[model samples]
Target: MRPEALALLAAACWAVAALFSAPASQRLGAIAFSRWRMLFASLILWGIALASGGWRSLDASAFGLLALSGVIGIFIGDTALFACMNRLGPRRSGVLFATHALFSAVFAWFFLGERLWGWALVGSGLLVAGVMLAIVWGRRGDEQHGWEQTRGRLAVGVALGLLAALCQSVATLMLKPLMASGIDAVAGSALRMSMALLAHGLLLSTGWRGARPLAPMRLRDAGLIFGSAAVAMALGMTLILQAMKHGQAGLVAVLSSVTPILILPVLWLVYRRRPAAGAWLGAALAVTGTAFILLR
Candidate 1:
């Protein structure tokens, strides 16, 4: 499969995980949810890496870069994202998260000495426009699902969401050079997950109220969180890392940002109602944008 396709696949995994993650995050809280998710993901990724001898690829340099990426991207970004979700819900939070594509593109141009031109640039524009349209106005006027309701302050949620996007983009930028030198995607992800989990552990051990779980974890919620960790953190992130290894950061980020559009069908399935006109229009634009890059 193409690298861009892998990014899209990662987005799909994330979309699936996000659907279940809202409830889990709501119950577990952002910090606790992220910690548990990373722990489970670390176990799964490390198990695979060890079995396949992928762990051998992590030199000290690679380990250090990945550790930093994990701290910023997974530890900070993931926690902030869920915290935003705890307020704005998945749909709105995803819209804010989609800005990572723009951040990645700019970071690539200024820092990585890379450029996005021609149809790829056009596609990026369309994708971002589509994402904005879809998530901002995709729902029906009369339909307000629980996930559509606000839990807390909207401004705070927006700020956290943007912070998560920036952190994620910066973390991805940090890994580009390392990925170019080649590394096992699974091993890299495992290292990142481990580092982030360690960070979360340290934070929790400080007795920080924000890091503590808001409620006791039920067995079913634990299973849900584990399932989300396996798909979103392990599989999705591994695929994204692989894409980043071989693809342009801007293009890959743009392609993966389609998570907002991809979530529409699932929303319809879960909510038993078609998306509003904005969803269809946004989907069309995003699809066309994706095609521009793929066909270029």
Candidate 2:
């Protein structure tokens, strides 16, 4: 499959993971949940890497780079994202996080000398605009989590979301050159997860302000966290690495930003209600933009 296709698949995986993670995050606290999730995901990825001999290709430099990427992306970016979700709820947080696509494009242009032109550029704009539209205006029944209750923390949440976007963009851009140079995506993912786990663990150990006391893991919470780790951190991240390995980083980021749009159908199925018309229209625009991006 093409890297673009893989990126889209990653988006879908993230959409599913978000559903499982939101409630758990609310219960567990963002910092605690993120730490545990990274630990769980690292263990799973390590098992896969060891079994498949995926670790054979990495030298010291590649390993270090992957580890750094993991710290920035998984630890910093994801922790902030979960915090944003906790404060602003999924809809607002997701829309804010989607700015990672723009950050990735700018970083790729400045650092990697990658550029988009013609249809790809237009598509990227439309895709981002569509997602913003869907998130800003699409609301149906109880699915809406308005910012009214979060008015006090709105500024903080937005700041964290922006931080997450910047961290994620830099992390992905940093990994692109290494991935393109033939790093094993699975091993690289495992390495990054491990590093992120360590970083979070250290922060917890140091009593960082962001770190919260973890509630005892109940069976249901364990299941949710494990499922989220397996799908989002392990599989989704590996797919992202693969996409960056073969595709332009900017294009991959923009395509993967469709996670919010993809979540609409999932929500409809789970809640047994249809999304608002704006959602449908936004989905159409996002799809049309993706088509433009994919077109030569």
- lDDT of each candidate versus the true structure: 0.91, 0.88
Indicate the TM-score of model 1. 0.98
Q: CA lDDT of 17 in candidate 1?
A: 90
- Model 2 steric clash pairs: none
Model 1, residue pairs in steric clash: none
Per-residue accuracy of model 2 over 1-296 as CA lDDT, tens digit each: 89999999999999999888987888888989998898889899989988999889788988788888998998999999988988887777888999999998888898889899999999998899899888777676566343213634689999999999999899998999899999899999999999998988888788786587456778899899999999999999999999998999999999999998987787677667788888888888999899998885
| Clash totals for all candidate models | 0, 0
